[model samples]
Target: RLFAEKITGTRRDRPELARLLDHLRSGDVVTVTRLDRLARSTCDLLDIAEQIQAAGAGLRSLAEPWADTTSPAGRMVLTVFAGIAEFERSLIIDRTRSGRQAAKAKGVKFGPPPTLTPEQITHARALVDQEGRTVKEAAALLGVHRSTLYRAFNKQEPTP
Candidate 1:
């Protein structure tokens, strides 16, 4: 039986992979094009291997001779690769988090900038509240959308 999943291997619950696991039987060999295609993490790979073994089945990787779970040496090599994959994943996560922290420390802001300036918002609020100008009129005069002006005006309100 052949099962295919387009989901990333890093995800824990890939539907096709789960189906394949469920359908596995004794002596069945689950084959993949590559070890990376099967799992992105060592723990996940090891867990899947254990599950296959429990089902009296084995796993094979077409690209990696060392990924044959039916042989002792292949299992050992796969174990080593799993450790390396986990270490590599940890290093990548650390680098990404550090880069984000550095960017934040440097005052780098994410997402779109405010649509209206502080002065423009103050003027819009005054036109709407003090002069009793409609939101549409204030927004048209300030060259902004009525919804944008409305949101800004609501946020700027003083508590009673």
Candidate 2:
């Protein structure tokens, strides 16, 4: 049996998992302590399990007590649990949507703050115009990137 015991915060990145995954073959059984230990996100959990199943292996969560791909009953139970998890995720999404709507009604804009100030923009433009530096060089002097300079100049062109 593949024993997946609880991993601590220190091991959350799980550098060793790739090695285990690379070695796992068809008809192999992967056992883990719990679903939470299996994945930090529901989507990730499903993705990992899908990868295992695609390899012709099965996953068993010891803590879940019913997650077994080896038998029909186990598969049925897992399906029900997956449905429940999906429903829960949907509910969260709906609530988030409503909350965002309410926030938008209040004129709340959610996202990162603007990186450059008006003064910085004017300075960058002045430097580019006065200095013999190219756009890339100007961006380098300003500690930004060429893409940033292009955006500031409104020179967006579709890249192939």
Candidate 3:
């Protein structure tokens, strides 16, 4: 049984997964604890299963209890489930993309708004003019990073 590196948190062993794939032969079986443990997403699960089948190996999901490809019923169920999983993944991707597009159309900011408010920018720039303090001194007084002050007032906005 081959476990994914992402779960174990030891990424240097990914090449070991490649080696396991290379060593597969006919009638070999790969087992997993659970479907999600084997793969975080449906696309990832289907992709790994396809790779195993291509290498002349079969997959057995312990939690699924009926995914063994050696049996006729198991093979039938696998074909149907693989199709279902792929469809489910595509649906999720489409939904996520649509949601993001809708948010953008509504003018909802994708990330945090400008770190400093417009009022703060004016005050900071004034301090820079009146007292001749360094940007870092004004930023320290404002309780923000020096880079935040620079990004808010010193840097020019990009032109469309």
Candidate 4:
């Protein structure tokens, strides 16, 4: 039986791939034209390979002959490659974290801009604190949710 995925290899939820894996019997070899056609990343490839192995089936890639799980040498090579891929992914994560930290130190703000300006927040607080208006009324006047106004008030430091 042959299985082909119509969706991009980047997605792991391919119906054909699932059906193929489910139908696999012992001694069955699942073949792909290339390793990239099977998975988006090395981790994804390893995960799929593990699934195939668990189902008592073998995986083979024509473009990457060393990726075959049928032979001991091929299995060893795949394991080594998986290790390297994991290390590379960790390095990438570390670099990304460092970049974000550096950006933060430079005063770069992340996430959506504040819903209300400082003046609007102050006015809202006054409406609730000084004018004795209800939080819901103030929020309605400001065109924001009551919870948003509450959070804004909670975040502000007390005035001396």
**Candidate 3 lDDT, 1-160, residue by residue in tens:** 5535443422334555666678788789987777666554566666777888888888887888887766778778878977898788799899999999999999888887777877788788878877798899999999999998888775645222
lDDT of 4 by residue, 1-160 (tens): 8887899987768999899888998899999999899888888888889999998989998988888899999899989988998899999999999999999999999999999998999998888889999999999999999999889888887545
Q: By TM-score, who's the top model here?
A: 4
User: Residue 49, candidate 3: how far off, in angstroms?
Assistant: 2.9
- Each prediction's Cα lDDT score? 0.85, 0.73, 0.76, 0.90
Cα lDDT tens digits, model 1, 1-160, are 8888989888877999999989999999999998778877667788788899899999999998878988899878877876887889899999999999999999999789988988888887778778999999999987888999878867775523
TM-score of 1: 0.54
Return the candidate ranking by lDDT, descending.
4, 1, 3, 2
lDDT of 4: 0.90
Clashes of each: 0, 1, 0, 0
Using all chains and alpha carbons, the TM-scores for the candidates as numbered come to 0.54, 0.61, 0.54, 0.88
Candidate 1 global CA lDDT score: 0.85
User: lDDT at 38 for candidate 3?
Assistant: 57
Best by lDDT: 4
